[model samples]
Target chain A: MPRDEFERLDSTWASVTPPAARRMLIAAAAAFSARGYHGTTTRDIAAEAGMSPAAVYIHYRSKEELLFQISRIGHATSLSLLTAVTGDDPVARLASAVRVFASWHAEYRTTARVVQYELSALTPEHLAEVAELRRGIEGAVREMVEAGVAAGAFDVPDVRGATLAVLSLCIDVARWFQPDRGRTPAEIGDLYADLVLRMVGAKAP
Target chain B: MPRDEFERLDSTWASVTPPAARRMLIAAAAAFSARGYHGTTTRDIAAEAGMSPAAVYIHYRSKEELLFQISRIGHATSLSLLTAVTGDDPVARLASAVRVFASWHAEYRTTARVVQYELSALTPEHLAEVAELRRGIEGAVREMVEAGVAAGAFDVPDVRGATLAVLSLCIDVARWFQPDRGRTPAEIGDLYADLVLRMVGAKAP
Candidate 1:
């Protein structure tokens, strides 16, 4: 990881007010990523943060609540990143979207793992909340594909299927990314962006 | 799911000796998939199998062992499917490989879930054992990609990266597949086959 990327990952929780709450969220994400959500207890989160177990309750009512916060923030951040992408054309826009979205998963592997894998551990109501955000994420990708197709810049037989494949390819990055091995996140982003353009039948940019 | 597909999923454990042990493995897969390895207990597995808690021990030493068995078997089964694909051309072979491998995740969603997600819970020795099968799976895909490039049937800039994307796209089907919604497993297979060929720069079949 580059120094800037490392610093950016460390500052993921900077927006969370009151350092104590942010600390708990970071601890919970680490625990959940290292062990499955079910395997981590509130005490474990507290211990990881060097705070008393009761201090954890002060910021979050329960472990699941902490998970929900981590998940919501992570999803929102990724969605913003996707929607915020700027490019000169549909092809460039979609490629840029894939580049940033795919790399985010690699750079923020810990939060990405917890966000992607631990959804089933959330309460039904909380899951519903996160699912709405997920819909936004999916919609963002779909729209980019659709725009490229509509602009006659890309050829896609089944837009939904193509969109699914693109998102699936990117989302699985969190599961397998290794910091010490293989390509850097930016390199992955570049590779994926090129491959995704192929899938969508976008002309070479 | 079709009746034949349902039966095929049920027969997944048919090769495991002794109907009693097969039943226990099936039970463990269901439990581990539903509640995750950490949230599930030996008692839960036994209850799901309709046997005493002690009966579980008779079949498998521990819950982690049961997970190991499911992971090992599932990985082996998918690996065989990938390597068994036969076609007159590299394009056809790669398409067949992706089709079956991706659909297997959907058709056998329960086992696939446990197989892909619960590996972390396996003991290190068991995990290493399964990782060998995983390597075989990766090698199978890489070889098919290499064959395509060698035959001038596909244009791939990065063989290793393309191979990773191909396998990643297929393996992730397990995480999002829903039996009651959207496309059938076979339909997904067809869609993915087309998209993957597009990915490798294979001409339309």
Candidate 2:
């Protein structure tokens, strides 16, 4: 994508959260992704967000809360995308799902690097919430697989295992996808959509 | 596996590194997996290995070396297993590759978790070395994929992308596999083997 298009794509969370909170979350994701949550102090987050160190507490009660917010929002966005996918053709739904899912991880690599890899940083309560959201995302994929199997459009031995593999393949894109390296988000999405269709034993289109 | 068998399996690394150095590596993997590379101190690793804090530097010069060691060995181990997989049939090769790959991630979850996730902490020089090792592992998978495609055993549009997805699915097993929660390592290996076969459009066995 073009530079402007990339920035526009990145500003997606801006409309969802308040300006200050979003800045904090963005700053937190950068820091956490670079050095990890435990190594990143609230002061560092405040500095990155261009606020006084004490300003962090006014927004998030603790550093973990900042992580929790980032994790929740990222997972919620993914879950919403997965669950909102519609239509009777399971193959199409799975393709669309993998496309956006792969694209999001590539586009928001920074946000996703923390969200997917830094789950250990969250407290128990927050981790449970994030895992539940993850389960929802997995459930959506499972639904698509089951539907496809029922329709004889796809053949999968283990729906749950295949669902996990599908998500895992997409999520790891965040870990390895660099802006300058390899394929664009759209390219990866298209590739993964095809690969996943094959994974489900869909007849060649 | 039985407890003794688990102990024996965990000893896969012991023969390569001396007992004390292996202890430090084991301790470091646990700490890095739990708290991440930045959050984990040499003191924590030493303590985990039941050594005085100063004793850590005797085996490993710095915490980063400990991480590098674990990552290098883990990658090497994975690469060895992947490249050593032999068979005339590419489909069988892919299935065997996924089986052991997924099983290693699940059985050696703690070690695999640190090796795969704590890589960001490596210095540029060390990272390049580790990346080279990783490319070897990826190359092995890609080779099997290419062979499958050549023999008309698999129909994959993007062989490179499909190769990545297969390994990504297996590697993430380290991140999420819980020993107490569900399937054993062999079961997951068998399941992933089947899923990967479907992914490559291999003829059903």
Candidate 3:
């Protein structure tokens, strides 16, 4: 089930953020992801968390801050999950990265939906920070593409475009995934890993 | 720069839709794309369209109607554009379709963004209509992929997954396209066509 991913995400979040604050952020993520940032109110978020509206400010300075935290945590987790796929070969690295990235997007789709879609609502300062983390994720993918091309492990015509497409395909999972629908997260990850390998023109291990 | 695409979309919209109603839809599409559907107010749309608040109601019954219209038009255009690319050969058809679809997404990004990203704001009845339209686009891609594989022109192992990725990559252009960014819509179209051609393991003709 999704319990493993949720627990993993929850513990990872708790490592850097307080539990009460994380609860508020979780509520904010769901509301923001579903109703959108502008549609969601602090009162709605507090109500979702089963707390009085006044209690929100004790944990988050504003509704935007709640969104900012969700975006931040989501980006950090995405970047870390992507960059963690390390190995001696770029082919394996790329496939592993795509698998993990795709899995996380599907598993944590609620948080990812807000993170990926609600960037415009973030304060400029916060948006910039999130963008940097996004760049980190992009950079990790670009590195794998370059490594594969340099080693002659893959035959990509346009490295930058392929890198963008790879990230694009993975991030879109958050947009379209429904847990009960067609494929499981693992199935999607496995499918995408193969498709990505083909994308890079990887011959074989 | 993007004027050609804007004019083209405008003319296409005018062909079937009334000019005044189209104007409101254009405004709502921009607002919904920029600020999100829920984030954008009917007042904001009316003001942006240079009409009084009540003028908006004269054209469209409600803000949701405005969104439904835009989504409907966008889906129609997307389906037409994708299916319009036809040839005896699957490779050529697929490349042409991706090129046109990607170009439109980049060129008419605001409309495409609202069409692609703002569907959740659409009421269920409207969303089902749009989803059928979306399925048309998917069916077009799937046919091309299946034809390519059947003809032995492409080497995709998983037809459904590859179809999903091709559409995923093209649709994502709406999410990330910036007119002032590095690549033009035409350029992106050409780049994606080549990449997608490569993606299907098509042997160079």
Candidate 4:
């Protein structure tokens, strides 16, 4: 966890908090994450939120719309988390990015799971939009890796491959991580951040 | 891939290739993979197989049984692939294992997808069985990492974390890979093999 990267994430957090919308987004994210989009109805979301199903329609036009909203928020939050942690030094930036990523996945496991797993169920239009959001996140990581390579802080033949490796390490956390699985999320996050930094040939801190 | 892993996979292939059962399993795997287990009806699998709905019941006792069968085959195939690729040299063994894994996920994307995405829909007994099978595969990888460390071929403080990083890279291929995505399966396999090898701090060939 580099100090600079932590500041980047904190700044993103500052721009995105409206109490009511945040609560609705959290409920919607949980439902969408627990069940696949097609498998979850608006009623399920409303029930999770302790509101009537009709109340959901007031905020979102349709099921697809709700999914879109969730996807957008989830993607933005992840990007912001990454953006917040990026530092001037590529090695510190990479390690901090991995730390933020692993922690975010653990904290928002359900939302992350739904966004990753349920992409196929989105309408073509919505799917493209989600894909774009994903690419934005990937692109930012790629830029960091390229910068690292330029500064000789990393040694990799392919920046794209390194980006995928880093992202995969974080995304797969949701698959096996259990709250009672003998390791705290922060511990796992720190270990993974170190592993990823080394994977990219970053000097040991 | 190691010759032993290849032999094991060949053996499993031989045992599971009775035409009727193979066809049924393939059909069920595709349906389960696409629509998920609970979301997919027995009639859907029957229709996909071009058999009467009753035909499915004749072969398998219940939908749950069908899923269990698919899970068994999928896990067995993955384990066999790993066993086939392991070598005496820890670095070569790790690279070969990951190459086989990535290639298998590409070739059997549907089966891989079903085995991964539909786990939550399985009965408790079935889930435990699948979990055991997964543990066996993870154990094999962990042993390889331990061997690598013992041989001074790799540098990692945590064997379990290193193993997870390697597995995560391969497992995620099923999600974002497409034949039309500009890289052939072999290319993707090779690229990922290199990444995993480096992640463990193995020397390049």
For all predicted structures, in order, the TM-scores are: 0.94, 0.92, 0.94, 0.88
Give chain B TM-scores in order.
0.94, 0.93, 0.93, 0.89
| TM-score computed on alpha carbons, candidate 4 | 0.88
Give the clash count for model 4. Answer: 8
Q: Which regions in candidate 4 have their CA more than 4 angstroms from the true location? A: A1-28, B1-18
How many residue pairs clash in each candidate at the backbone level?
0, 0, 0, 8
Quote the positional error of residue B78 for candidate 4 in Å: 0.7
DockQ category of candidate 1: medium
lDDT of 3 by residue, B112-160 (tens): 7777777877889999999999889889899999999999999988888
Indicate the DockQ of the complex predicted as candidate 1. Answer: 0.68
lDDT of 1 by residue, A134-178 (tens): 999889999999999888999999998998899889988988888
Which candidate number maximizes lDDT? Answer: 1
Clashes of 1: 0
Residues forming the 10-long window of minimal summed lDDT in candidate 4 chain B:
B1-10
Alpha-carbon runs more than 4 Å astray in model 1: A1-9, B1-8
lDDT-based ranking, best first?
A: 1, 3, 2, 4
Q: What is the TM-score of chain A in candidate 3?
A: 0.94
DockQ of each: 0.68, 0.65, 0.63, 0.46
**Model 3 Cα shift for residue B78 (angstroms):** 0.5
RMSD of each: 2.5, 2.8, 2.3, 5.6
Q: After superposition, how far is residue A77 of candidate 3 from its true place, in Å?
A: 0.7
Residue lDDT tens for model 4, A1-205: 1233234433433444554444455566666555566556778878876888887766778877767766777788888888887568998888788888887776556666777777777789998887887898999889889988899888878788778778877987876676677777788789888787776877654
Return the lDDT, model 4, position B158: 84
Per-residue C-alpha lDDT of model 4 across residues B77-148, encoded as one tens digit per residue: 899888787568998888888888887777666667778877877889989999999998999889888998
Report lDDT per candidate.
0.86, 0.83, 0.83, 0.75
